[model samples]
Target: MTNEKVDVVIVGAGASGSVYASVLAKAGKKVVLLESGPDWQLTDLISSEIWGRRVKPAGAPILLEGKNPMAYAAQGGWGVGGAALHYYANFPRLLPTDFRMKSEHGRGHDWPIAYEDVAPFYDKVAREIGVSGDARAEEKWRPAGEAYPMPPMKTFRNGNIWLKAFEASGIPMVPAPVGMNSVEFKGRPACLYDGWCHVGCPIGALANPQVTYLGEARKAGAEVRAWSTVTRVLTNPAGTRVTGVEYYDDKHQKQTQEASVVLLAAWSAQNPRLLLNSATDKHPKGLGNASGLVGHFMMSHHVASTWAMFDEDVQNHMGTIAVQYMSYERYPKKSHDGAFGSSFVTAGFAVKTTDLANSRADLYGPELADYMKRAARNLAGIKTFGEEQPNVENRVELASEKDEFGMPLGRLIHSFDSDAVALWNANFEEGLNVARASGAKEAWSARGTMPTSHLLGGTIMGTSAANSVVNSYGQSHELPNLWVAGPGIFPTEGASNPTFTIFALSQRGAERMASQWGTLTN
Candidate 1:
């Protein structure tokens, strides 16, 4: 056991974990962030898509057994910067109505707080991270928040091709908000516009955790130890507070780190898995499983691409691959009765052979050769992001199998409900219509719906302790000193990339924890 104690110990040096470390450490707390992957840094981020796969998490494999199994290996982060190291940095905020779904639509669970409550944090993170976009262009669907810090990213010829389709179809399109810099800000360089971002950005232009909070945390004197896998959350005899955690160091030796406060930001699935695996005599279900909802409500969005083949070269390989144009203004809520979620349409995607969305892995021989030849210079792509409703049946449980550390493996089970399928169908049709209207010589979509890496729910936050593991601030209802950070606390995730929201919530929770340290620790 390590006798030295700290004020805060955070598990997972990923996006939200690094945010808390940065904020609380800056506020003078003794903080330590434990990461289970390699000690990666900015220089380690190579420009090759194959090399970028190094950043994806690979500590322990969870037994995925769902009709819609999430692609965790591709979406999760393994090292210092975490998943942000290779992300496109699509930084759109959640819609306002997303917070009050049950109240307005009588579908999905309502968030404990509203969009207004998180708006300030959104602005704070945006300014700090230097987001780029035109707020007025997104005014129709954008929630109330301060304007982006930088000008929108440069649009390409592919955007022009998609813009006509949106216009002709009477759908609205706006410049997509992105975390990559449009201009030099806060000492970071500007983007190179090489469209090679699918792998990772070696330059500091993209606001990955290495260039953002994780960097700030290092400057603020927060200690981060890589290959430190936390296995259990140690608690007091009364099970009312957490003392710290037990983890395996790089040597695979069991060690203990003592702290007054412990926070778990180890992704959506692992957060609940850690809680459940920590089951003890005092709490057999788990540290935060008294409510029996810690592992329930696991959800992931369905992302489908609609690619168009143009007669003339649209320069699809030109600019940012995340998306050049965005559309959300044409979503008809009344038209789709069974579908009950937001639809986020993004245009301008470059074909990356590593990505399943672009590669037809099932095709071979002449068909494969022909498809590759046509896709080389003629393909322009758009994607439809449909939010999945929270279902209790989709959950994470402790599998009978154990890892090298003797800890039970996490069993992830998820399936698309009727409503989710409806939402996907509706969103897919909407995307196909826009593509056909664009005067493309050919238009086609991915063979089937693809599960997004954007995982949510599982150990959700709510007003009551009976149904939720944490509160709006990510404070545990069962153990005050043990909180679950990250997207796992989300009651409902809107059809938007969650990295920005993760940063905002981490900022909010960390700021509050710093301000109310005396009360929180007591």
Candidate 2:
């Protein structure tokens, strides 16, 4: 095996990994970022919804294909930028009460670090990534922080409809906090309100890794080696620290790289997979698997959508992927009963012409044509996202089956408990009610099946080694030099999009690594 040395080795050049690489490299540390996919550029992001499907691999849409398919509740993105390349840019922060979910609501475990502790980092990430929102509008849930770097995207037709419905229901609707550019912050141009973002933004208006951390990291002299899949992390004989990583390059040739520290930012599934695959004599089960919690406690938010046929056209498919509003002011509170509050957003409704045409396939001739004709108009829709409690049994484990690489594929055996199911049903009904209040001709609620975009808490963070894999600062309790920098470290899945939180945690981990750089031996 060939060996090369670096100060830090980061696996998975995704959202979290990109930020960590940028931060550490900017601090003048030598870093190598290994990604399983090819290097993609903003220009390469196709603008068609159907064509964007090519960006992610088949079978495993959101995650990289391994031994077993990596299943996400929504859908995931793969490749050099990881899932961030396909993110909707919804950048809401975790509500303050989200930190103490178990204490306040007797649900999931509380975070060792509170919203207050990470508030500054959140602000830093928002500014660095260029958030365009009105923090004042989110006063009830957002922590006290500096103003948004840019103004909010203009309200769209569907947003206006949803606003009225929320007003009628006594639920306030505020501009959704998005990472897309509103006024050209960070050298990116403002959004053109093209409504084609769900397909991936070709323009740099959306703050995907290509425009944010990846660019900065590359400019800072860090090397991102794409199509280099890390199979296992190697540690010293004592199993006290990481030595380097073994990977398969684009040519399928095995190679090794040494580093003083190794950071696993490969999302919830693969992070634990690498650790488990790296079993050695010193750590028989796996590296840092002393607690055997590496692949436990998988959490994903429950998402539900409500569609309405409004009397007036509410063209929703007209702005950023997610452009309208969010309601979390009274979330997770008593008003919602035992059901937790959900973060709801109303985007310019997608025109149902395509859906209608697809649905007409079973029907014949004139009836199909008539249905398609009527579906051409804008149909307003609102989606509600609710947090799921992290359950240890809902986990990612190595399947008995192996992939082409001879590595055990990640198999997700997740089941939502009764409480989570109840919360989902309640949120769906709430969304439908809002649609009705908006004076829609008809409203339909769609429950989530295998839909998930935000995956969190597999190798969760906690105060003790007995209960968690990582500590509050993201350092692995079982392996000190090994760190996790992603939503995987979250102890609880808060009712917000996790991109911002991932960046905050990455910044925190990077800072700690920088502070302790001297202690790390190369």
Top TM-score prediction, candidate number:
1
TM-scores of the candidates are 0.97, 0.93
Candidate 1 lDDT by residue in tens digits, 344-368: 8788755555542344656778887
Determine the backbone clash count of candidate 2: 12
Number of the predicted model whose lDDT against the real structure is largest? 1
Q: Go through the candidates in order and give each one's C-alpha lDDT.
A: 0.83, 0.77
Tens-digit lDDT track for model 2 on 490-514?
Answer: 9887778888888888888898888
Give the distance in Å from residue 411's predicted Cα in candidate 2 to where it truly belongs: 0.7
Model 1 stretches with alpha carbons more than 4 Å out: 330-338, 355-362
Looking at model 2, residue 83 earns an lDDT score of: 82
